[model samples]
Target: MADGGVDEDEKPVGELFGRLIDESKAYAKAELGLAKVTAEAKAQAAKKPALLGIAAFLFLQAAVVVLCITLALALATLIGPLAGGLIATIVALGIAAGLGLMAKKALESGQ
Candidate 1:
């Protein structure tokens, strides 16, 4: 201590600012680490739903294939096998085209 009991290492301005800058740097680093951990946790939480979405997409594709086969077989009981397959393909293509047109119209209207 100095004669007035002030700490000898204390400077009026320079020491205070230096400590402030150091603390600011440390706080910034800690905040960045916290943000990284938070992002990782959020990503982990979303992983299961992401995987389930992919599984659902795969299952839907399999179901569509099975349904198409069943449709063709049912038609074949009435029409011949060749005509049934052709009719099924044409119907599927027409339905897909109709769906595409509807989607385009909906998007345009939304905009």
Candidate 2:
């Protein structure tokens, strides 16, 4: 050993290590930014199909409503409005009562 065992030649190696650390951090930041952008794009892409599904469901509901109206109108044509209204109300009530009775029976049997 010479000059009291002091070393100054490792300074360049330390600087190079520091630079590598900084560069690695910058690369990781860039990759994270890219991932965020990709996720946003995928989310946006998914929204269109979701909206379309909602629109389709709404349209189907509207079609069912229209079909009911058409049936009511046809019944009105075959019978007078007063009689058609009475018959439709009776039919709906009968269906409801039947369903209720069936549910009661099923519940009683289960118990």
Candidate 3:
């Protein structure tokens, strides 16, 4: 036996190559397993924040709807129910269209 602990008759080239390949496969499998566990942990950490964000978004949407209804009703007192509702609808649609165009432009620029 050599000081390095290898036999004086070195391993054949094919045998060494096979060992290397097996070790490489084992290393790759370990890395993949670690990555999967890391991803799962990150997802679990984000789950609560993601749910809270969705809830906040829904609440904001409700608030916007309430504001629109209030505006329509207030206008109704002055003008009339039908005309007030129409005006409110038109205003909301115009705002939505403007925001949509802005969002589209932003996305296009980012891409």
Candidate 4:
């Protein structure tokens, strides 16, 4: 805007630096906010109950398997070996089939 150049005394360095500092502060604040949001999002995802529920469910299934094996072994010892083995196999297959059917139905129903 100056025809050629202005005198050095007329230049306003203070105003220029003031504006730059304000813009820098705003940018820094915006970056800090973004980082905070990202950290919170990660923490919330980790804290979700779905993960706990899944771990609990897996523990329950493991307990059930151990119990079933113990019972089957006891039954086999009390009864004849052949009959006990056959009975345990049948029961295991039946449970597996039932679980498969339940899972299929749940999937079909979309929850």
lDDT of 3 by residue, 1-111 (tens): 879888957967888889899999999999999999999999999999999999999999999899889989999999999989988899999999999999999999995
Report every candidate's CA lDDT. 0.90, 0.81, 0.93, 0.85
lDDT of 4 by residue, 1-111 (tens): 455587645669997788889999999999999999999998899886878989999999899778777767878898967777677778878999999999999999998
Higher-TM-score candidate among 1 and 3? 3
* TM-score ranking, best first: 3, 1, 4, 2
* TM-score versus the correct structure, for each prediction: 0.71, 0.43, 0.91, 0.48
- Clashing residue pairs in all predictions, respectively, total 0, 0, 0, 0
lDDT of 1 by residue, 56-88 (tens): 999998998788788888899999788888888
Candidate 3: Cα lDDT at 96: 100
Give the lowest summed-lDDT range of ten residues in model 2. Answer: 1-10
- Model 1, runs deviating above 4 Å: 1-17, 109-111
Off by over 4 Å in 3: 2-9
Stretches of candidate 4 exceeding 4 Å from the true structure: 1-55
Clashes of 3: 0
Q: Can you write out model 2's per-residue Cα lDDT over 32-65, one digit (the tens) per residue?
A: 9999999999999999999999999999979865
> Candidate 1: worst 10 consecutive residues by lDDT?
6-15
Instruction: State how far residue 87 of model 1 sits from its true place (Å).
Output: 1.8
